[model samples]
Target: MKLGRLNHIGVATPSIADSIRYYREVMGATEITEPFDLPEQGVKVCFVSTPGETGVNEALHSALNGTQIELIEPLNSESPIAGFLAKNPAGGQHHLCYEVPDIAAARAWFEGLGKRILGSTRIGAHGTPIFFLHPKDMMGQLTEIMETPKAGH
Candidate 1:
């Protein structure tokens, strides 16, 4: 299966608002999307577009190669990321999401290799099908595989 692109870096936070402030004031990131709840996932999510990667042409970087930082906050105590926040109250990087042409194929390939998939494919924040690969099988990082968005979103 072909890996498409690095979609976003998931960051688990106690407060998405606070994280937005830090990203704006400290990191000087200004393209943060509004935080929205994903009840099915028991979390609130926002995306921060990051520019200025070293060695990349700024024009092309902003136009086509920019990356996103997804800030995720638990909706309630029962949220899945609640435990992660409990372990690190300050919040931190949670997972890495990668784009794939076909999530179904990616899932089958991983399963064929005997890797554990966290759950059945579900609609993700990007409005695309996604699935998570267990950290143990993926070098200690929770990996999200998402189907590439259709043209025009």
Candidate 2:
């Protein structure tokens, strides 16, 4: 049940393209991944990498480096985040992902403490097994628990 590093910050967006442009033009983000669709999750996904974290040495960190921003857009009306987009219109931060050494152990620990799990563990954007803790049980914020990524991933 050991928690690893903060993996990423999930953001719901009306359009990944627009989000990418803003991140690049407004924030000077230079490392953005090409947007891809995850039909199984009903969303288009892209990652925005951040550098220049305070007190952090870039040479010491790997590719995952600082926490990333996951820009997510509904791929269809059935997308899980569609309702969020409808309410937000402008979209906003969606969830926070944290890495865990073992998905099963983390899940069991949370369950033992009476926290509600959102769904069955599934493959996440990072290609690692992940599960969500219900917002109601996690301080009104959806929290994603993901398996720690392998080196050089």
Candidate 3:
């Protein structure tokens, strides 16, 4: 199967507001979008984009010029970010999502290799079909495979 572009890098944080401030004030990055809550995912997310080397936040921002940095703050203890933070108190990179042409084929390929899946495939907020490959199968990184919605239904 063919690999697609890196969609976004998910960063787990204890407080979305704090992180937002850091990215905005300290880093001097412009907000690409406001923070929005995704109850289904049990987290609040915000996107920020900057021009070039202005501060610490913009430093990492340049590396992800074409992509986005998804700052995710867990809403409750049951959230995945909470679990990740429990293990890594300072928070950490949660997962990486990749746009794909065929999520089914990607899933099948991983399964064929005797890999375990964290959960069954499901449609995301934007109607994109997505699935997560167990971290064990990917050297400690949770890999998400996503496909765009079809023309009709």
Candidate 4:
């Protein structure tokens, strides 16, 4: 049940293109990954990396492992994010993802604590196992638990 890091903040967006523009122009984000579609998840997603500690050192940047903004747009009307956007047409923060050392152990630990797990663990956008914690159990913030990505990922 050991926690690794706050991986990313999930942002439900009606349009990935517009979101990317906002991140770049308004938030000063310069490290956004290209948007890609995940048909299984029914969402188009991208990662926007925040500028790390004030330094020009690439090595230090890697070490810092700055959290990312995971912009998510529905791939179709039936997508979960589409539902979220129904309530928030402008779109907004959806969930917070935290990395766990072991996905199974983390799930069990959460269950033992009476925290509802939203669904079965599955491969996530990061290419690692991940699951969601129910918003009702987390004071209304839907939370995501992800298995730490392997060393080279």
The C-alpha RMSD of each candidate to the native structure, in angstroms, is: 2.4, 2.4, 5.5, 2.9
After superposing candidate 1 on the true structure, give the runs of residues whose Cα lies further than 4 Å from its correct spot: 52-64
Runs of candidate 4 with Cα error greater than 4 angstroms are: 54-64
Q: Candidate 1's residue-wise lDDT over 1-153, tens digit each?
A: 876678899999999999999999999997999999999999999999977566768665543465699999999999989999999999999999999988889999999999999989999999999999999999999999999889875
lDDT of 1 at 36: 96
* TM-score of model number 1: 0.92
TM-score of 3: 0.78
List the pairs of residues colliding in candidate 4.
Answer: none
**Across residues 37-92, which tens digit of lDDT does each residue of candidate 4 receive?**
99999999999997666665976666457789999999999999999999999999
RMSD value for candidate 1: 2.4
Weakest 10 consecutive residues of candidate 3 by summed lDDT: 47-56
Give the CA lDDT, 0 to 100, for residue 25 in model 1: 97
Q: lDDT per model, in order?
A: 0.91, 0.90, 0.77, 0.91
Model 1's alpha-carbon lDDT is 0.91
| Better structure of 2 and 4 per lDDT | 4
Error of 3 at 49 (Å): 3.9
